[model samples]
Target: MESIVMLSGNVKYTITLDPSVWIFDDRRQDLHTYFHEQQEEKDTLEEYTKEVSKHWDREIIEGAVVPPTLKTEKKYLKEELLTGTFCIPFKPFLTNAEVSENAKNLVIETVDGMVTIPLTVAEKMVLGFSKDGKPLREDGPIHCYYGDGSNYENPIKNVVSFKIE
Candidate 1:
């Protein structure tokens, strides 16, 4: 099917990925901003401590106020889903397929040709399924991108399947 990509080869399970539903996934990333933006890593422990301290202080001062308005949150999310460009990490689907321990490479089957990369690196790949608020049906069920955004402009197109070797 145009919306599915099969993940097979040296794996415990053969899985089918449907990019069409990824728009609803919480983990989907904005494709437009992903390549242009630089993210700063924060200390996880410190961030957690600060958030907990803030929550404790708020609860102590206000005695457990009602939660934030879901109506507003839902509105914003709905707008984004309708107009925002998006992508999802390829790693999750690949991990779900459970690559066999002996597998060392990931061979991407594209419309152009087969492109091979070390499985270690492929594990971090991001898949661009939509662009400019539209599914990339012309050349994709997905376009494979290097995790670091190196090939964002020229992503591997027409991803038919992923073969682990």
Candidate 2:
């Protein structure tokens, strides 16, 4: 089952899993902490400014001091499906029996959390698993596209092509 897959958009290309290839450290920080901290700081600053303004005769600057905008940081895991050593294309159809047998091995970790590879990719890689359920191959060229999740003018334009080798 040798096939070629191509993709575009946000993607990372790596032939194999190398510890050096991991861009982020394995530290999981609470995403909400940063936001809450910023909010608290902003509130404290506003209160202090208001108190200080009362002592001055001039109308203190109003609304000019903007709290730092809280931007969500993208969390990178130790293993990400797109960043993993293996690349599998999306498969749309599988029989009940095939799904039952292969679905267990299709789960992959993403930045958003765990996601399963499409049925077709799972089927192709069914025989590629090892005794411990890990893939035997260390390198696979798979293309993936992380779309914006918006409706595209031509939906197929975002289609990724991959070949099973």
Q: Best candidate per lDDT, number?
A: 1
Candidate 1: which pairs clash?
Answer: none
- Every candidate's lDDT: 0.85, 0.29
C-alpha lDDT of candidate 1 relative to the true structure: 0.85
lDDT of 1 by residue, 1-165 (tens): 367888899999999988899998877889888767784445768988999998899889877875677579989988888888898877777778888888999999988889999987897788888877788899998998887889988989998888899
How well does candidate 1 match the true structure in TM-score terms?
0.79
Per-residue lDDT of model 2, residues 36-129, tens digit only: 3322113657877987876452335435443343122223332342233322212322231223432334344322344445544444321111
All candidates' TM-scores? 0.79, 0.17
Clash count in backbone of candidate 2 = 9
What lDDT does candidate 2 reach at residue 16? 23
